[model samples]
Target: MEIRRLAGRVRTAIARADQKLVTFVQSHANLTTALVTAGLALWALSTHQSAIVLRMAAAGAVGYFLGLTPAVCVGALSVGFSVAISLEHGFSISNLIIEVIGAGCSAWLGYQHKMQKVRQEQAADPHAPQVLPWAVVNEIRTSLAAIRFLLFPLHDEEGSRENQALQQATQELSRLEALFREMEQRDRAGEGR
Candidate 1:
């Protein structure tokens, strides 16, 4: 019990610290980006690290933190400085490729972040499409399917009033299922974007 309590306290402390860090980053985005970029520059220049992955990650991080403009600026700066350093030694085709790839990563990640923010804003609007929880929607669909089966035991009749009503009910259910399917597809497409 004592150990569990201590662990709980530690978890709470860690959570609080994480929240504080996120708050600071959000509130001081420019400062955070500048600081991170400066660190990246120092690390890259001092070590003369030509690791394309490192460049890409640094640029992407800065891009994800801000919007396209800052990301593009960071990408350009990083690529230009790295290329200059490479040129000082001799023109290396590999280094140029790495720099270009890093710049691309920066642009792509930044654009993604900006689009994500826009999506969040749209989701918050009442006019946006209603998105039900996927699992719950699936369960509802399953239940509807079971009810449909139960309603039409053997065969669907066209003439009898009772069967006609059941047929109409089945048609409505089918339409509802199609609607949910469409919604699911839309949700997936949105995520892929």
Candidate 2:
């Protein structure tokens, strides 16, 4: 009983810690990434070790995890740190050039990896809400409205039952389209919040 109680307490603590971490990450991802980058750079400088491959991999991973802009920033910071360290010792132009190229390339590679992952996820998630471009949505709506307008002329050219049915179907299409638009807007607003 005591062991179970202890285990429960541990689980609760772990859950709380995880929740806190999630909140911190979501709220201050950029700040956390920058802080971590600085810390890693400082560690490398202090160790007096040129961890080039490690730096490259880290930059790429950060890019993948954070995004393209942050990845680029990571590469920039890495280059900055490398320059500072080289200035302290005998400056090696060749090493600096390699580092510059490596950092830039790694960042781009990571961003590409991230984009691929996004595509894969979207492909896998069949039910995922697809957010179309606003302009495209507007264009489609305009086309539908124009079609409806053409179907519903001011002068009734054909008062046949088939014509009335077509008009009703178009009205139903318009209602459904408006509902879809309203739902999409709500979803977008919710995402922003």
For 1-193, candidate 1 gives per-residue lDDT tens digits of 9999999999999999999999997877645544544554455466666465466666677767776677778778777877777687787776566566546655665667668788899888947557688886786787677666657656655567566667767776787788878878988898798
Estimated TM-score for each candidate: 0.36, 0.46
Model 1, TM vs. native? 0.36
Clashing pairs in 2: none
Give a tens-digit lDDT track for model 2, residues 22-136: 9988777545544554554555466565586577777789978998788778878887887888798778776666666666666766777788788999889967557767976
- List the pairs of residues colliding in candidate 1: none
Lowest summed lDDT across 10 adjacent residues in model 1 is found at 32-41
Poorly placed runs, candidate 1 (over 4 Å): 1-50, 124-193
Give lDDT: candidate 1, residue 132: 84
Model 2 stretches astray by more than 4 angstroms? 1-50, 129-193
